[model samples]
Target: MDVDLPYRLELISDLPGHDERAWQVAWNPTKPLLASCSADKSVRMYSYRPSDHGSKSLAFSHMGTIPTGHTKTVRSIAWAPSGKTLATGSFDSNVGIWEREDVSDSEDAGETAGDWECMTLLEGHETECKSVGYSSSGTLLASCSRDKTVWIWEVKPDADFECMGVLMEHSQDVKCVAWHPSEEILASASYDDTIKLYIDDPSEDWFCFSTLSGHKSTVWSLSWSPQGSYLASSSDDLTIRIWKRVEEHEWKSVLELRGHERSIYSISWGVGKGASENLGWLTTTGGDGKINVWEITEMQHTKDPLSATLIARISGAHDVNDVNSVSWCPRLEHPDLLATAGDDGSVKVWRVVPS
Candidate 1:
């Protein structure tokens, strides 16, 4: 351990209930629950509480397990802004919508937790669905697939979804889809080494407004800055590119971050401790088994639009197992906390502590 580092990752708990490789982990936006999906075709939920008053550490306990009912591996999971619904993307070429039914009796005077049920299953993708995401307003859901397409769905009441549009502009497999923090803009990364941005035109249908090309290899994941002014993408080229929105529908690469030795699988940008300034932190992990945290600062009155400083690095984060996913806790009060899923089928909670 390097004491001179500005920050360090302190392990809080290792959740080892998944029977196969854990693909993704997501934190609830309005609740204490953390969800992880695995190649075992199951989704595991965990709830956390602070160890003590104003404590930085959290005690996590397994809440429940959902045997997703997908015939293939569950590749990705996402939570809606309200934390009331969960979306699961599976290799079975389908997406599953899950929600907990309130079974608490009104006469009991105490609210009882309910079991998670697969409320709806969305089918369309010809191949595996790689990622799923909900818009900031929770009115729409977007999913991408290995079929080289991105599907947008209008989220209606009563678990009903209508297909808004099917985008087929990508030449290769679509790896990830991310919605802007406060806007309806959507970005999708692909195995074709490019990222495409889409917006629904009021007079017309949804269309790709811009295509961003820079990565020399597959673009694996995408994350938007806390304010949605910038987008960060990780790629098989072993580098992360930060794209800044210059014009209304135009984005250009502002900076490239290099540290990981292998393909970066996941990247998450969040308001981590620096929320006051509106400059968020970016966290990344990948096949090199390392986890990195960078403090992103916006530059004013300079030619450069932004800068990134590597504040913390954890090598062999999963003990030689490739880290598949990394997600920051969405709650503003717990900005220093993050969760990661690994190839070892384990989900771990960590807190960023000052050295």
Candidate 2:
């Protein structure tokens, strides 16, 4: 993890496609493939090669084009770890998984001239599909909707899929859902003001393992610690809460990260090695135009979290714009980098310099 040094936002490149907002941007875990989605009803992948020379064109490698299907707006996008498939959720209440195929491969690894086809259109969620994610193993895909339920699907080895289960517990729209890195346990945050953790079962009895309560307002974002021991959530309450599973199903609030004065939009864990350190560090963005980095400490993780310290923070980040999403780059061999998007219809990459 980087030391307590404030990150300097370097304007690597600006992608302006969405007229209203760039809803989500996903970076492929394999190469430097970057995919961005927007309300303009388009998803474009960018390949930025440091070795390439040019101002307008060579700076970006536009890979497979994602066909926009939703009627209203494209809200979310997630790339499979294999970097071959992408899952997208939209305001149209539809979830589409686009699989990339090799059409005319010129040569080499970096050269990919292929087209994307929407192989699967999942139909179950009743309202706007806000969030979606591929499981740790990429075999399971989970999505949350405005209908207050979490749906999990089992992707077969034969490239087809089946509806595994629907987790019903939250009282309001399920805003966010995340899966543990090594286990099948799922955590979901909702506008219902609570976060519920669920475990899968063959008996169809999906019960809550723990109910996390701390946010004074709607919880919009939830993330599992890469190792699965800690959980982090951001809310309209203007604060981020951290929870830990001390025992089996018994979880406790460990940290209340308060830096953003406005509603927090998204949260993501730092990339580390094992389940313990995969997300040992954390970062977040908010409507206050600020970006903050936090170190999940052992002392603040013991019930009294107010004593925790802020590691790094960048104020007036997107100036007068609401920061929509924060993400730790998955090509995590270089673990100190992060990618962020905002309502200003721009994406910026940050290098968390270790001091």
Off by over 4 Å in 1: 52-54, 103-112
TM-score of each: 0.96, 0.88
Per-residue lDDT of candidate 2, residues 1-355 (tens digit): 2344544334455665556687777777776677878777778777765545643222545554565777877788988777777889988888888876663433233356557788888889899999998888898898999988889888876468788888888999998888887787888999989999888656765567788888888998887876778888999998888888888777788777788889998998765322352235688888987888776645535546433445667876666888888887776464666667778877666655534
Off by over 4 Å in 2: 1-7, 52-60, 103-111, 272-279, 300-308
Question: For every candidate structure, what is the RMSD over all alpha carbons to the true structure, in angstroms?
Answer: 2.4, 4.0
| Weakest ten-residue segment in model 2 by summed lDDT | 271-280
* Candidate number achieving the greatest lDDT relative to the actual structure: 1
Residues 1-355, candidate 1: write the lDDT tens digits: 4566799999998999899999999998877889999999999998887767566667888878999899999999999997889999999999999988884434221124788899899999999999999999999999999999999999999999999999999999999999999999999999999999999999989999999999999999999999899999999999999999999889999999999999999999988885476477899999999999999998888888898988788988889899999999998888888999999999998888887
Our model 2 lands, by Cα RMSD against the true structure, at 4.0
Report every candidate's CA lDDT: 0.92, 0.76
Please give the range of 10 consecutive residues that has the lowest summed lDDT in model 1. 103-112
RMSD of 1: 2.4
Colliding residue pairs in candidate 1: none
